[model samples]
Target: MEITILVFGQIKEITGIAAWQISGIKSTEELAAKLVMQFPELALMKYAMAVNKILIQTDTELNENDTVALLPPFSGG
Candidate 1:
């Protein structure tokens, strides 16, 4: 299974793209872990993920066509 991962901010800079395809997701937490492994820089930043625009926990189940967004911490008050 393939899923689309959308990156933002420094994540995009490190990963070098705003969107890309990757292996299927087993668990949300695993997804983050895999990304961090692929892009070591991600491990040093604060990030969160959303599935299909819904904020989900690490255990959230991902579907084949799920859209996962990787967002770095935002600062704008």
Candidate 2:
């Protein structure tokens, strides 16, 4: 399965990419593990995971071509 990960805020700076693709991810948790392994910087940051624009708290089932967004906490101006 190919998943598209969207990085935001400091994550974007850390990963140095707005979006990228990864394979063999069936759940959100698995993706998270892979991310931390690939980018050790992520474990030190705070963010939320969302699939197809919906915020997910637990390990959500993923499918091919799913777009997962990593969103950092937002602040109002």
Give the top-scoring candidate (TM-score). Answer: 2
lDDT: which candidate is best? 2
TM-score of each: 0.86, 0.92
lDDT of 1 by residue, 1-77 (tens): 77889989888999998998877576788888898899898889887789988777657877788889988887888
lDDT of 1 at 1: 79
Enumerate residue pairs that collide in model 2.
none
Task: Determine which window of 10 residues in candidate 2 has minimal summed lDDT.
Answer: 68-77
TM-score of 2: 0.92
Q: Across residues 1-77, which tens digit of lDDT does each residue of candidate 2 receive?
A: 79899999889989999998988999999889899998999999889899999999989999999999999987868
Tell me how far candidate 1 lies from the true structure as C-alpha RMSD in angstroms.
1.5
Task: Give me candidate 1's TM-score against the actual structure.
Answer: 0.86
Instruction: Indicate the worst ten consecutive residues by lDDT in candidate 1.
Output: 54-63
Model 1 segments more than 4 A misplaced? none
Error of 2 at 73 (Å): 1.3
